[model samples]
Target: MSDSEQPGPPEPDDSDPPGAEPSSRRGRRPEPIGDGVGAAHRTWLEPVRSRLVASGLTLDELVGRSGYSKTRLSELLRGKGYYPSWEITYSVVRALDLPPWPLRRLWTAAAREAAKKQGWIENRIQAVQPLGLEQPPVAHQAFTLAMRAPYAAYARAFLQAEDRAQRVVRETFDILWLTWDEACATADVKRHAWQMLRSRVMARTLQQDGHPDLRQAAFFTAAQAAIIDLAERSAHINKMAGFFDAVARLPQDQMDVIVLTHLCTIDAAAVPGIVGLSPAMTHTLDHHARGALNDLYRQHTWE
Candidate 1:
């Protein structure tokens, strides 16, 4: 059979009422809109969908308020088809009276994950100007300053460029600013901020065989602190490669602790604050991580 003759997914019936599920699509699962990005971006969509329900407005009402067709709104709400453009997404956001910047950030992230080009993303976002969302609160500014260096260090260790690291940190801070109230409500906002930074950096980090590929960072050796003779430096770099590979294989919690304390050289006393763990717990994880690395080293030596 020719490609053009192959059956495609059913199209929604325009005759169906604005909010009604198309009969053709009934009981058929919609393919996820942005599964390429992972679940975090999709989690951000849940609340926006809930907002439509919370408003108690029918789809017809949202159509009028958002100036978008009901069918379009339905697809956006269901995450059924193409990842909606920020222009349409923001219009619904405004109509729902929800906060815009956070959704915008998430939407942008999902769009990127969907492989949308930068020019398209930028053009869509420029359609709506978000006022009052531009300014970060005083507390956010203070936190950003205190956390900026360590966050950049952690990001650079994974991402390997000053510009990329700075961009990731800035995006993390912007997200933190949007969610400051929720972060402050937690036991430690610093830890909350760190997780946000970690998520952004790790999203950009390369993967190898289901683990983060940190071996590349080891070869990019100018960022390392140690200074040694030429031959020694080469040997040291090779040693660091094995160390980073081992670190990459560590469990998530252990890897976080190792990256922050051992690689970035943040003080152990301060780690609990950034990781949102109790000091004793941080110590335990660190000890376990060291033990695991030692075991890996011994196994390599034996082999």
Candidate 2:
């Protein structure tokens, strides 16, 4: 089927007993639409608004610069009614000449919270028939799963360029859509999606860097130092910078272990499947990673 022919929700069967809802309605609570999400949405967009003001850019200027409609841009700044698309958010960031990192991070957090409040993922999942069923796969459902995957974590692990990371994520979803049937057969769809995304991101990073070894000592050091500098101002950012720096310094195997266990929060038994390490070896690597992080922290403090 063409990608444009998106699937609608399955038709309800009439065989159900009276007063019984569809199976999709079973055990699912109605999604909350309350003040919590609105507060988070406002919190996330406040910085964007502040930056735009500080940059001396008006909504009209932003609309002209970003090529987005003034109404859409205004809606995004107000953070009400609808969650803005990533494209719109990115355009606004570019128009304001703001550093994308912190704003992107805030946007991600806010978007995720808003999605949860609305039960967006659950609603999307329920809208489609089960994978590998008689019906053809739904393009929108596949896209939703890909969007909900941890592309950000993989992007952080391999690439520093925000635009490149975004591209990788978009490509990951495209590939997922193409391979939807194959993915449905997997026992763990989310893990399969993550692996596919990681491999693609890693390959892209390797191609772009053109270095025999993608992980360069100088590059890691520089990136870590920048994180550390940010850490000086915020205690939370400091802890995160130290953790990322230490992870970056680890050997490839140990780094994979830490990322899988800590970042991905995968179980120890599952590490072997993902990284080809034994459970025992995974535990050992975790122990060593901790020690290495401690040592790195001390060294940073001393220096």
Candidate 3:
């Protein structure tokens, strides 16, 4: 056959052969897609879709009744997207005039299964297990570990009072005892516990100091005084009191960033994970904190 007349390789087939896996454009096995939640979501919604079809409900009717776009309703019925939010699911159930109980059960199961598969729950359990907190002997071991954790310093600096910090840590462990299952199911269990303690300490300190607003409180002076008292009582005290005092005066968000980054020596990237701020927000807070610290030093003539 002449070059021009030569037959091209067989046209690519769009359909896969029976029992064959799907291939991607690069001819590799298609990457597993979706967060597995969508599969459970789809499975759960299948019966609801069947019910809608059997009732002769049209997309137009569903859209009008549920106030969802046709595309959204189609996606929900076809299970083409992430698990639908509760609002979407409930709206559809109401629109279909179906008993909400059955669908609600399925939806809840799907959501829970998806959460488990994502490791959000399992990772938390693992985090606690390593600390031996999940067992009944949690009292002695967990309490000792929590008391000695480096993050404890961050809490003390945040509260500006050793007594208050100790109280907060104790209460945090009590809470962990009460909510052991929940703690084990949470993502970043240690961070969650630390945040809980920080919040409690902040609240108590604010109340006792009558600061009304943490952002406006003169925490620097208070922190310096607290650190000075510690320095007087303990031979182990260091000059870092001045630095922590400056950290104390920062706005709450900025203060949190400094404590997590400097005192805890956490990575800048992981600071956000501990403090529950976005990376951008954490960076902004860190910048503002450093600037504020410099301004404080200049004002105090601390060379």
* TM-score for each predicted model, relative to the true structure: 0.71, 0.33, 0.35
Best of the candidates, lDDT: 1
Per-residue lDDT tens digits for candidate 3, residues 9-75, read: 3422323346642221322221233444354465456556655755566666666788876656655
Candidate 1, lDDT over the whole model: 0.73
After superposition, candidate 2 runs with Cα above 4 Å error:
1-149, 206-253, 257-285, 292-303
- The sequence of per-residue lDDT tens digits that candidate 1 reaches over residues 1-303 is 544335444435434364765333223333345444345456456666655665677776777788877677777777767677787788888997766776787778777777666777776787777546455678888887888888888888888889999978877776676556667988778777777788888888898898888887667655344665777777767787887898988998899888888778798898887777899999999999989998877643311
Tell me how candidate 3 scores on lDDT.
Answer: 0.55
Q: lDDT of candidate 2?
A: 0.55
On TM-score, who's better, 2 or 3?
Answer: 3
What digit string (tens of lDDT, one per residue) describes model 2 on residues 173-219? 54554346556777766657667766766665644233212332224
1 versus 3: better lDDT goes to: 1
Worst ten in a row by lDDT for model 3: 22-31
Which has the greatest TM-score?
1
Count clashing residue pairs in model 2: 0
